[model samples]
Target: MKPLPSLDVLKTFLVVDQKLNFTRAADTLNVTQGAVSRQIDGLEAHLGYALFARQARGLALTQQGALLVAPLQQAFAQIGEALAKGAAQSGTLRVKCPTCAMRWVLPRVICLQNERPEIVVEVTASVSHGVDFSGEQFDAAIVFGTPSLKGVSTHHLFDEVLTPVCAPELWKARRGKMPTPGDLAGKTLLHPTRDRRDWLRWLNAYGYEGLPSTKAQHFDTLDLAISSAMQGLGVTIGDLSLIEEDLGARRVIAPFSLCVPSGAAYYLVYPERPAPSPALQHFAQWIEGEARHTRTHLAAYTKPIHQPIN
Candidate 1:
């Protein structure tokens, strides 16, 4: 078998051959003339043939050098093409999630992206009502609801438990009385406009027959809703997982012992038709693993409590 030339040597030879001057080639390559000369020398020794003829005028390619140029150029061209294709394939994976989910999931996603840099992620907050996955272009969506939509692949991420949260001052101001559905009649109710179903379901399950004409405040996003609650505007029912940080920080407090098991669950949904991209598949798997970790961690630290909404 013939001895293969080193890539560095071939690169140096190609540059020198094109420029027809060792000094110019060395300058272009940011290498010393002596280094370029040594590379040519090493290349010639390995090939057992002189590739360049040194002359008073400049460097000229010998017969062997001329013969090697075509194939070497072709090899480098192929390598460049492959690298370009690979870079194009390693694209960003767009993901959609609600603002509340983003607060919890973004950190996890950052860790995943760091580990798998080849897969870029673009997270967009979806504030619109319903799972409008079709309206937007996203590789995957993390939605809060049961897997009821047909023709979509849904992976149950987590079950949500709703707790009524209000500013700590609001709870204290209530004067030791746990607020009931009747008490909420005059008080402001900060509601998430994205999914009214959540509040409706809670109201139904609690046997609130007459819908109260209460002072209502609507927020287009969860963050806004939570912020409103924090400012002591009104009580907001929020997912336990999402508000765990707030509860720990004493930013918000559960005033009433009444809680509702939200029928909604977080699900990772993707199109059922075409096969998922490799990046999407990797992300889905990582999310499920993270969910498992969260379940285990929460189980150890927190005790499950059911608070019925009155």
Candidate 2:
């Protein structure tokens, strides 16, 4: 056996192989393009074969480079997993949560720390609604979609119930009356998704035939959109369960009584293989209990909206 190439060079090779461009790989690695070129050159020298074929357009991964990609990815993943397990032993559980669910998960995380000072829960909020356990190092994730995620044990939290919410003052302006479809005429609509799926679903479920032609603002996440609504910017659709505190505190009020199910629910998801850490187990049990409480409390709020308006 000969000598092994530097781990740094190998890592750089992987990045360049994935990107197929030194400038983009350097951008991702936060290094200069020249530095990335040097690392690839050194790695190819050590391997005694050309890893990338440079063309007029760009670089393509040679057969040899393609072969190294999967193994390197798996090796790095295993190393990361080992490091994460070592960190977990220190009594910390890292959890990934969608920004929209932060309203629901953050308070519970604080309460959990208060109740169980021995366990520390670190929550990372992201705009993405799903998590990729393969690439991500989180002990678990609070995913906000259907239970279609594979190879993970999913613990159902609660189904998302969508309804229009706005600042208390906005609702009060209507003389404490429940807002009808026509009330949305002049006000700007805040959309959580670019396609405005949430508002569309709620309107369709409420039996409104035409889409509102009012000015609209789109946000990357429901949390931002709801936050905008609380500032009296406009009305946005919100998940009834997640905004329970906002409703209770009168920060935001649901003007429409008909809250329809969006067919997606939040789930506590973790890998099925390599049994979960003890810290994960404890947090999972605690959150599952909290979710149960929420489901029971919001029972009336999430009732089916099929009945006709009086």
Candidate 3:
């Protein structure tokens, strides 16, 4: 425990590491580029190692700098989440979730807000997969996969099963004969740009390999792809958690008993801190309860029970 660098220096290092451009980091910190440079120099002298390397693109972390990134992120994330608690209504809570959750969770959040107007919660949307909570200023994130990120606490929301979903009219068009996974061969399939692998995985499970991969329509988000499915344009593989409302409303149905796990699951993510912050605790309890309701709906909808039971 020798003389360590201050929080300001560490924060500057993190921003520079995150952006890899001192100028951009300076703009974000509301400081001059020269000040940013000086901070880095002083920090480097304190630690007695070169923290960055000059490259054509920008500053790259040296081995020493690379080692510090995760720990530094954890330290700051804890501080930020703790402070965010005090900053909530007394200090506002900023939450980040991806598109699919945005559609499904917004109403629930509003309900939570209504119940507890005392807490101020702000929710923002992003592509949760591979998103860096460290730089996003998020007190928490509802991400599409398990918690692998360094600085955040992750909770299992639910594991996803990709179910082939299509409009009720499309199923009815088949005229009462139950549709099977093999039936997808003759129909258009919708693909979400981010999780297109689910389509291939499901196709392989059903042995529908001969269909041309490009035959499917692709959309940038899962919400868009499912919307296309609801219009009777085609069938899309849906994570039941995301499409629970549509399934319950009879807007879409899984045509077969077959459901394939996407090998990824939804997780509740927030920056790592020693103790639970007030805001984080409030949101976690509320969101986990919402997810439990969703899990039950997800389980019920993946079956073709909407069709006449045999």
Candidate 4:
């Protein structure tokens, strides 16, 4: 069975049918005439009939459209009445993330929920890069890099800092000496297979022209790659923004005293329409606060870069 047209489409159909002019209908709806035409097209497609007849002057309703007009108008009136009678309901927010943020940001998000004790946030994480929200169902997403979607809104979360990090024991085995970047020849390189750009940039920045790309253990996510690094397994490129806890706890040591920006940044992205929901707004504010606190706390522990590791 065919689905009934939505209230918005029905409303548009009624307005255009009454005005007999696309321009007049658009003006009344405060939308472009193109929008009005599209809505009518959608409605007609849904009903599998032509809703408007092309006329020299303007639009004229087809027989099928005339039949649907009264019922659709009445249906929209009922929907509006119900809304006016306090039929609003709160909705759950579904969010997705990359593996890096899952470790730090996700836990902090739980704290945000506890602090407010009112909002609910459902989070999912993956090791993949560049998730397509267009096909997926999500109220918002905390993703790497800027949001490029046309209708999407973005909030800058934080910049990424990449540095070589390893377990304390691994560095201790180095005779308590900070090794140069070229010295990485002896250690295993735990690479985040998903992100290639930063790894290359890091190597190029330190002038490690001949640094042999030896594959030790490959991980798809920073969380896993860094975990392996912490196990004295290999050195991984750590996103400092996500690994502040590990760094502060001395679980990991930055061998090279220098770190560089990861080129891309984290962002809070959501569809922009009628403003954000209360839950989404609270989540956004909470993440913003968390990022601020993280940056501030990190500045206290910021160490100066030594002479080049090359």
Stretches of candidate 1 above 4 Å error?
Answer: 1-88, 114-116, 129-135, 148-151, 173-187, 194-200, 203-213, 272-274, 293-310
Candidate lDDT scores, in order, read 0.72, 0.83, 0.76, 0.72
Candidate 4 weakest lDDT stretch, 10 residues: 80-89
- Candidate 2 lDDT, 150-242, residue by residue in tens: 668999988888888999887544775656888888788999999988888888888787667568999988989999999999999999899
The per-residue C-alpha lDDT of model 3 at residue 25 equals 85
Candidate 2's C-alpha lDDT?
A: 0.83
Measured by lDDT, the strongest candidate is 2
Question: Residue 276 CA error for candidate 1 (Å)?
Answer: 3.2
- In candidate 3 the C-alpha lDDT for residue 154 amounts to 78
Model 2: residue 199 alpha-carbon error in angstroms: 0.9
Position 255, candidate 1: lDDT:
59
On TM-score, the candidate that comes out on top is 2
Model 3 over residues 1-310: C-alpha lDDT tens digits?
8877888888899989978998998876767999999999999998999999989889989998999999988887667666655555355677778886677778888998899887777888865453454445667778886566775677888877777899988864467676655566567888876557777676666656644434678888888898899999998888878877778788998777767776778888776654556767988988898889888767755553222111
Winner on TM-score between 1 and 4 is 4
Error of 4 at 88 (Å): 9.1
For candidate 3, list the clashing residue pairs, or say none: 87-91, 87-92, 88-91, 88-92
Model 4: how far residue 299 lies from native, Å: 3.1
